[model samples]
Target: MKDKTLLFINGDAPKSLPSPANYELIACTDGAFHYLKRMGFPLDKLAFISGDFDSHSGSDEDMYEEKFILTLDQEKTDFHKALEIIQDKGFSEVDVFGGSGGEQDHFLGNLTVAFAFKDLMNIKFYDEFSEYYFISNHFTLKGAKNRMISLYPFPSVNNITTKGLNWPLTNESLSITSRIGTRNFAVEDEVSIEYESGDVLFFAGNKEIEYPTIY
Candidate 1:
C-alpha cells in the first residue's frame, strides 16, 4: 500500500474503496460532502472540503462547517479547487473518485484538470469501470500482462518507445494530427514507456492498475 490521499467529488462513489492503508487521508469537494454524509460515510475521517460551494445542494451545513475552503474562482471546477489544497498539503499521490458519472460536462471538465495537473502530481481519475492517469516521460507498469492499455496524446507526443506491449513502438510519434495509440494491450508482466515530450494519458481497462514506485 502507498501513502496517497483519496479525494471524493460530486460524482457517484464506487461499490468499495481502496484499502485504507493505501491512503493517508480523505478529502471531499464541497459538492460531495453532503452526499457522502447522507450515504453514511465516516465524516470524522474527512480531512477537509474545498470548493466554491455553489453546487452544494445539500442542507447539511455542519458537514462543511470547518472543513470548507471558500475558493471563489469560477474559472476552475470544484475538483480543481480540492486538488490545489492537496498540493498545498504536500500530497504527491492522489486517487480521485466521484469525479465522473455525473453530468457529462462535469466529467469532461475533470479530464481537463487531469491533463493540466499531470506534471504537478501523480493523479488518477477513478470510476466504477476503470482508472486512468497521465504517464510521465519515462515510467514502468508492473504486473500488467494482458491488461488493456490505451495511450492518448493530448495534442502531440514525440519519441515514444514501449516494451512488453502487443504492438511495440520504437521512437515513434503520436500526434493529434496523425496517429494515436488506443486499445493497446500489455503483452508482458511489465510494460515500459519512454517519451521525450507532450502529454500522453494512459488508461487501464480495469478498476485500477498498479504503477511502479518512482524514485
Candidate 2:
C-alpha cells in the first residue's frame, strides 16, 4: 500500500513546492504560511497552520483563524510543535520542506528534532540539494546510480558496512569530530547500508526517480 504521507513545511521557505496531491495531509508553520501565501500556494488545502504567531499581524490571524493552531510553548520550535501535531493526528510518514536554509543553527536544531522523533515516525527532509533522514540500521536505496550520497554520523556511528558506492565502508566508524563519509557517489543502481550502533543521517541527491518507499 502507498504510505499515507504528510507534507510539512517549516519556517524557511522552500524554493519550490511539491504537489499537494502526493500527500494525504498538508500542513505548515505559520512562518511558512506567509511564503506559501505569497507564492500563490493553495492555502485551502492545508490541514492546519501551527506556530507561536509572533510574526503574524492581527489581520493575518483573522484571515486564517479557522486553520490557525496557536502553539504557545516557548521551549519548542514551530517545526517541532508542528511535528507533534502531525504525530497526534496519527501520521507516521512525513516529507518535510523548508527545514534547511535560513539560519544554520535552525538547520542543526531541525536535525536534532528529527533525530529525537526518528524512532516514532519516518521523517525525510527535502532541500534543493538532497533528501536526508535518519536511516535504519540496515537500509537499501534503489535507483541511486551516479547520485551523490552522504553518510554522516550524529556525533558518532559504529561498525558500518556498505555496498554499491564508489568508496564503500566495511566495518568502519564515522564521527562528527573525526571522519565522516560525505561526497560519495553511487556506482550502481542500488545501495545497501548496515550499521551496528548509534545514529546515521543518510543524504541522497535530490533528483526525481522511480524508487519504492524504503523508510
Candidate 3:
C-alpha cells in the first residue's frame, strides 16, 4: 500500500473513499475526477486528470486547467494513458481502482488494458470487494483458507499448477472463454499459482494480499 506511489481512479470507483495512505499521487480517468471530488476528495491530493473529456463537467475545466491533459487519442483508453504518464515519470507500479463495478463493456476493456501493460509495469486493480492482477509467470496469493479465489486464463494457458487451494491444478490447461476457474477457495494460509505459458488473472476477495513465501 505505502509502497505504491500512484492511484488511478477509473470511471466507476467505489463510492467510499479509498484511504489516502494507499498512494502518493492521485490520477483519474474519464470523469472520475469529478466523481472523486464529489465524493469528498480534497483537491490538493490530486496530481492530474487524464481522459478524452467526453463526460467531464464544464465547471471543472478551468479548475483543472494545469492538471488536466486532454488526451483525444481514441486509440488508447484512459487507463493506458495514465500508465504511460506514470511510466514517463519513471514509476511502473500503480494501484488502480474502478476497473470494474461499471458498465459490462468498460469493465472488460479495463481488464484488456491491464494485460496490455503486464510487461510494462506492476499493475493492480481494486474494486469494492477485491483487487485483481494478471501474471504471466509463477505467482502466490496469500489469504485465509475458504476465502474466495478465482483464476481466469487469458484465452489459454499451459501447464498450470497451484497449492493451498481447495481445488488445485497440476499442469492443467485452462482457457478464458471455455474453461475458467471461478468460485474456488483457499485451503491454506497462502495460495500458490504457477504457469508455464500465457497470462492468468488472480482475484483476492479483499484488499490485503500476503506475499508468497518465495516472493
Candidate 4:
C-alpha cells in the first residue's frame, strides 16, 4: 500500500494557498523549505526534506532540524531528489506546491517530472492560479464549482477521451500536435476523465495568473 504524499517545491513562481499551516507536505529542495517558512508553515510536519543543500543558507539550515535533512548530490535536481525519496517511502499521490513558482528552467523541469512520472505515481502541481494533474486511469477533481479544467496529453498520449466538461470527448485521439484538449471548463462541481489508451495530463485553474520564475 502507498501512503498519501504531498511534495512541496519552492520554485520561482507565485502562489495562493488555502492555509499557510495545514497540509501533508514534503520539501523537494532547500528553497521550498524557505518558502514554507515565509508562508508561516510548520517545518516539523515534513516527512523528509531532500535536496543538495547547496542552496541552503546559514539561516535556512537553522530553521530545520538537522535530523530531517537528507542531503542529495548534484547529479539530480532537487525535484528529482525529492521524488526518489518519496518513491522510496512508497507514496502514491504527490502534490507539488512550490515547484512551479521558481526559476523558468526550474518550473519547466518540474513539469517534465509530471510527464516523466505519470505512470509511476499520481502527481499533481499546484499554484495559486492552477492545479495540474496527470491521469492514466479515471480520477475526480473536487473543489469549487465552475472551475476551468483543461486536459493536455504528451507526445506519447494517444486515443484519449473525456466526459463531464463543456466539450465532451468520446473516443478522441490526442497528441502534442493536437492541443484540442486545452481551455475547457468544468460543468459541475467535479470533472473526470477516462483514457482509451495512453496517459492524460490535466490542468485545472480558476483563472490565469502571472507565472513565476521561482517560488
In model 1, what is the error at residue 180, expressed in angstroms?
1.4
Q: Residue 9 in candidate 4 has what lDDT?
A: 72
Off by over 4 Å in 3: 1-3, 207-215
Q: Candidates ranked by lDDT, best first?
A: 2, 1, 3, 4
Consecutive 10-residue window with the lowest summed lDDT within model 4: 206-215
Global Cα RMSD, each model? 5.4, 4.8, 4.8, 6.0
Candidate 3 lDDT, 1-215, residue by residue in tens? 23454565564757576677667677777567766776777766777788887776677556766888788888988877888887777777788877786578888888898888889888988777777898757687655565678888887888899998777899999997678897677768788888899778888786434434331
Pairs of residues clashing in candidate 2: none
Q: List model 2 lDDT by residue over 73-93, tens digit each.
A: 989888889889988888889
> What shift in Å separates residue 176 of candidate 2 from its native position after superposition?
0.7
Q: What is the per-residue lDDT of model 1 for residues 131-190, given as tens digits with 9 covering 90 to 100? A: 788888988989788678888888888999999887889999998789999977776889
Each model's lDDT: 0.81, 0.86, 0.76, 0.67
Report the alpha-carbon TM-score of model 1 versus the true structure: 0.85
Model 4, backbone clash pairs (residues 3+ apart or across chains), number: 24
lDDT per residue for candidate 4 within 46-73, as digits (tens), equals: 6666766666677655656563566567
Residue-level error in angstroms, candidate 3, position 205? 0.9
Instruction: Report lDDT (Cα) of residue 136, candidate 1.
Output: 85
Clashes of 2: 0
Lowest-sum lDDT 10-residue window in model 1:
206-215
In candidate 1, stretches whose alpha carbon ends up further than 4 angstroms from where it belongs are: 55-64, 207-215
